[model samples]
Target: MGVIAMDKKQITLYYSSENSIGKQLNAYVESSGKDHLTIDISKTNVTGTQWAELADGLNKNISDLVNTDHPDFKEAYGENSVDLDDDGWLKILNKNPSLLKNAIVIKGKDFIELTSASDFKQYMDPDSAGIEKPY
Candidate 1:
């Protein structure tokens, strides 16, 4: 487990502000009024160990955290069945964080990879806690 992956009472968003989806995700989380920590990977450097822990926390392979179809990825490594182990994939992430697929929201001991705005409910469902409308 990553030491940084778990916060006591806040949502940790690992994302790049350079993308539209990421922007929307940030806004949604902000609107929730929950305490949050945003890590803009584009400007921040996440260590290899932290990245590995995040991947494991999400039950995914390190390569699965990458957008292999991204232009940068395609340019650097053509889609020629390039296979890499965990450490090898971590190197790619360490060197080029932009290739990351999506935001990773870590809350408590749980984490989810945000693919779209609709995915927010998984972490923010009001009914889960029986939070009624103020009406």
Candidate 2:
């Protein structure tokens, strides 16, 4: 009998701003040979619940990679500004949405929401992620 191999897909998260945790995550995902995806929420409108879902997916992805025995996972996990925990994940989601929501709400505009991990990851350039060669 032959064993079947599942195709591994990498997810990358990108943000327009620099000097933020999202940038660090982008670097991490790229170095890990994972698929690159980006979501530009800068001009998009999103609901609070949608933001929460995106954050949850990111949190889960990081957790899964870190828990694996992959060497690069440790470095990637450590590079984040937010610690890996349920509360921490929620904090990130809330903070990001709140930051955008507050500005938009005050101006009576809609805020952008990241719906899913894949939605965000689709924007990253694979080469930029630095995952060209497996370690």
Best by TM-score: 1
Worst 10 residues of 2 by lDDT: 101-110
User: Candidate 1 has which clashing residue pairs, if any?
Assistant: none
Report the C-alpha lDDT of model 1 over 24-94, residue by residue, as the tens digit. 88888888888998888878888887888888888987889988989898889997767988888878877
Model 2 off-target regions past 4 Å? 1-8, 12-19, 43-49, 55-135
> Over the stretch 41-87, how does candidate 2's per-residue lDDT look in tens digits?
44334444544444343343322221222234335345444356655
As a whole number from 0 to 100, the lDDT of residue 35 in candidate 2 is 51
Error of 2 at 88 (Å): 21
